[model samples]
Target: MTRDGPDNPARPLAGTDLCALADLADPGSKGFRFRQERLMFAGFVVRVGDEVRGYVDSCPHAGWPLAAWDDRYLTREGDLILCGGHAALFRPLDGVCVAGPCADQRLSPWPVAVIDGRVVTT
Candidate 1:
């Protein structure tokens, strides 16, 4: 289910701690899942240098999770976000899809921040 709504059980609350910044690579991505009863929230964070961006896991074109495997969000060269299901590419700084069937579409942003070296929902 979509985790954008406040009523979604799987949606993480603000201040939720995800992981330590150092645990993530300089140019890497990591997936996160939260569950409450039968509902589940799937999201990911991409780190590029000191900047980190977060997006909902669902792809706009297919309505499916972007990553085919764990934390495999970016392309091999690590320049753009890659949708494993449809081979769509997106700008990591913003969730704008640049290629594939979902071109011009965008991934939903999940507000997050790094506080005290920890990635936390904001």
Candidate 2:
């Protein structure tokens, strides 16, 4: 189910279970990947309060994965998204590029659902 918001949109994720919402620490993020045959899907999830937001792992500036290390998506303060490629910063709540080369661009949204306390693809 898609939450009605400018940041949230309905997306089909090929029926993949990302992780348990409880497994994600508040203000933390996790990366996920789904592959079938030669097709692959990669993204990350950020947990803020009781809400979780999903975004494509790719950086809008260089089309590179934002995290250089596993699940290392946030800045040092854990408030903004950081791109390891070009130091682009994004708003965690909506994946909007706040500062850097990709200013005004956005990370692609990957709609997710909270089902029975688990973060699952919509």
Candidate 3:
């Protein structure tokens, strides 16, 4: 878990609305940030067709952010999640690092779900 401080921004309360399903691109991704004073939480959501998965944005190999730009977490084909920091490839569905310095490692899951046409914390 990427704990920043006493304020656990990384884990939003269940049912917190993230974004509309329609706003999120199919086979695309979106980045999110939560803050409390000096502490900040970073995460991202990957949407593949009707499935939406969330993960902590930090890379397992170096603890750096995975994406260099906002909403640019997926590869060109949008089939896998790409770490902008080290060119790591991860499975969107399971956040598994299939190849890279952190092979066999996995991205921390950030519980989320699509509810009533909206993405929300779960």
Please give, for residues 1-122, the per-residue lDDT of candidate 3 as tens digits: 35733257555678889999998888999999886655677878999989999998889898989998888999999999999988999999999999999999999898899999999988
Residue lDDT tens for model 2, 26-122: 8899997655444556779998898899987788788778998999999989999999988899999888999999999999887887899999877
Tell me the tens digit of each residue's lDDT in model 1 across 31-111.
999998778888899999999998988999988998989998999989899988879999998999999998898999999
Give me the runs in candidate 3 sitting further than 4 Å from their true place: 1-10
Segments in model 1 whose C-alpha atoms lie over 4 Å from true places? 1-4
What's the best-to-worst order under TM-score? 1, 3, 2
Cα lDDT of all candidates, in order? Answer: 0.90, 0.81, 0.87
The pairs that clash in candidate 3 are: none
TM-scores, all candidates, are 0.95, 0.85, 0.92
The predicted structure with the larger TM-score, 2 or 3, is 3
Measured by TM-score, how close is model 1 to the native structure? 0.95
Pairs of colliding residues, candidate 1: none
> Highest lDDT among the candidates is held by which one?
1
Which runs in model 2 stand beyond 4 Å of their true positions? 1-15
Which is superior by TM-score, 1 or 3? 1
